[model samples]
Target: MKKITGIFLSMLFAVTLAACGAKAPAGEDVKEETKTEDVNDEKMTEEKKDDKTSAKTDLNVFAAASMTESLEELKAVFEEENPDLNLVFNFDSSGTLKTQIAEGADCDVFISAAKKQMDELDPNSDTKDSDITIDPDTRFDLLENEVTLAVKEDSRKDIRSFDDIKTDKVETIALGNADVPVGQYSESLLKNMGVWD
Candidate 1:
């Protein structure tokens, strides 16, 4: 009778130990599963946010030469409000940018100082990467500018305005080419005011 009682007590202890070992694996599995799910949830949230912003706004800007300073300032304001989208500026002489755009530069916006370059692109000769390009129909006027006369800082002749340009002392002046917008406008201003005669 004493031996049977000892044997029964040993059997009970073995079963309890086996059950405790089996329970640990289930607890570990649950913890790992919770961590994986949390990571997946965070990824989904970021994806959704990116999709929403991308759908609303994205601009590729190709601006004229003289407007470089102003356009950069505007770019900061526009980009801050549009975190998900991008605004890339292609700044150069209108002539150069237009040629590049026509040859196919990946662009979404083109700001020209003169309507001529924009018009020329009307046939949109501009292209990017040999595949992508903007069509002419999307072209429109954004703004206009006036011509200005500036002299070398060291030179002092009291040449304050256009009238001062007519003097024989101003027979020769440094100016942009006629094909350039500034040049075109200056020539027109001179022609109208009888300075080029």
Candidate 2:
């Protein structure tokens, strides 16, 4: 975990530095760089330190409930790896998290299970309320998850594939809240398969 966290932090730091135009010296620039590089490096390092110090230490992460287990593990590893960085996570339905963030909750990161919730927070989104303002530049797709249909291991019912869901063989189907990402996906899938009508 620590090793993974370290690598992730390094990549994140490098990415940030690259974005700020702190690229590696190349060709003719290398010769003229060494002399000024030391001074610039020192100044940049100091500035970075100062910026980090001045920035909020606590990062509020709003994520879907489905991500709780994985995020908890990451939280433990991340906090242990970066002692100075504190992460506080709020795990719930993506819809609920989006609502919280839109309602003025201080969230540094939001991981929605569905795109609809994230769309609502986009500052440029036509559907976004006046109160909801998310920086478009900071929003990016981070991950994609596969939604699978499952049943209890010891279940007596022979409920198995997606097609079986439409048949009377399946007694009850459990799904997330309609407003949640998982639920929305499930509904869409079922509707397309002619099972949700």
Candidate 3:
């Protein structure tokens, strides 16, 4: 994932450099010399027009809230290198983001924490039937994550694994709501353990 991210950033940097290095047409200097006053006036007008055209464009990115810290860090470097782009981020659960997209929210990029949310949005996916259309060619797995169970250091609970949660040593458990991907994973895991009833 890091390698892919590095490559993507490199490509973007190269494109930015190429655009910055572009030169004006060859005859523009000669034309400017012919009518200096008129050319200067036209130049200012053109510059102003160019400014309007080159103004920063807002690029809306909807991503899972788990990615908030990392994406925020990347945003700084990305915006610094691509001054013409202004990234507007909406960080929330993948399910929430999916709902927002389905409801016609403007989203230029979407980074889902789970495949289920993305699949639901894809018209080609067998798992869903919807009018949403996304370019399949642009979709790629950026990362893989694992679900873990943790306990406080000073806790007296005898829990050591998923099975331990079923014993009387455990009283209460905290799990995500069904609307989020992590919650779904937790539900699946608990169900498979025969303790979710």
Candidate 4:
């Protein structure tokens, strides 16, 4: 019985010693994960800094459909002088451009196709009342455009001038929107020519 008790105590002592030496693997794994996280965090911060440095002061310009070709040329010249300044253009009808500008789009400038809609905003070409996120006085008319009543190519209809559109069978005329500058000019031209009746 005494020998058996000694053996049992020796086994218990060995188990206690082994347990004292054995550390939880969980702690080591947690440390390794923390190291990995720190590395990722450092990498992400560096990437963010690089992006900030590379980012340019891009200026967004919305122009009229007719000014598409002309504006592209202007953009090239403007960008050359200001290399760090990027010029992005959105060319479309005046009505479309006005609505976008009114919605408070993040554009630096607006070159409206039609002065009528743009004039409704203001001389500066800003948005009307209703939550304007950008600067109010960021719009201006670069130049004026004239409108002419043009007929389709190779049409046999005798469309000599504005009066010709009023004649019979000239009903399906393709004109710009009323608020569009060209459309407004066209309307004025027809009214002055006494062909609106």
User: Best TM-score goes to which candidate?
Assistant: 3
Give per-residue CA lDDT, model 3, range 45-74, as digits (tens): 776656644566778888999999999999
Per-residue error at 166 for model 3, in Å? Answer: 2.4
Q: Mark the 10 consecutive residues where model 2 has the least summed lDDT.
A: 1-10
What's model 1's lDDT at 103? 69
C-alpha RMSD of each candidate structure in angstroms: 22.6, 14.9, 11.7, 23.1
Provide the overall lDDT of each model, using Cα atoms, as 2-decimal numbers.
0.65, 0.73, 0.75, 0.61
Higher-TM-score candidate among 1 and 3?
A: 3
What does candidate 2's lDDT look like per residue over 57-133, in tens digits? 67778888988999998887897787667787899888888878777677778888877887777767777653656
Q: What is the lDDT, from 0 to 100, of the residue 119 in candidate 1?
A: 64
lDDT of 4 by residue, 1-197 (tens): 00001000111111111112334387597776666678767767766655543554657777778888887888878877775566777888877876776675655566676655555445343534333333335545568676766778898877787666667958686666686677778777778878755
lDDT of 3 at 171: 84
Per-model tally of clashing residue pairs: 13, 0, 0, 2
The 10-residue segment with the lowest total lDDT in model 3: 1-10
Best by the lDDT measure: 3
Better of 2 and 3 by lDDT: 3
TM-score of 1: 0.59
- Give per-residue lDDT, candidate 3, residue 67: 96
> What ranking emerges by lDDT with the best candidate at the front?
3, 2, 1, 4
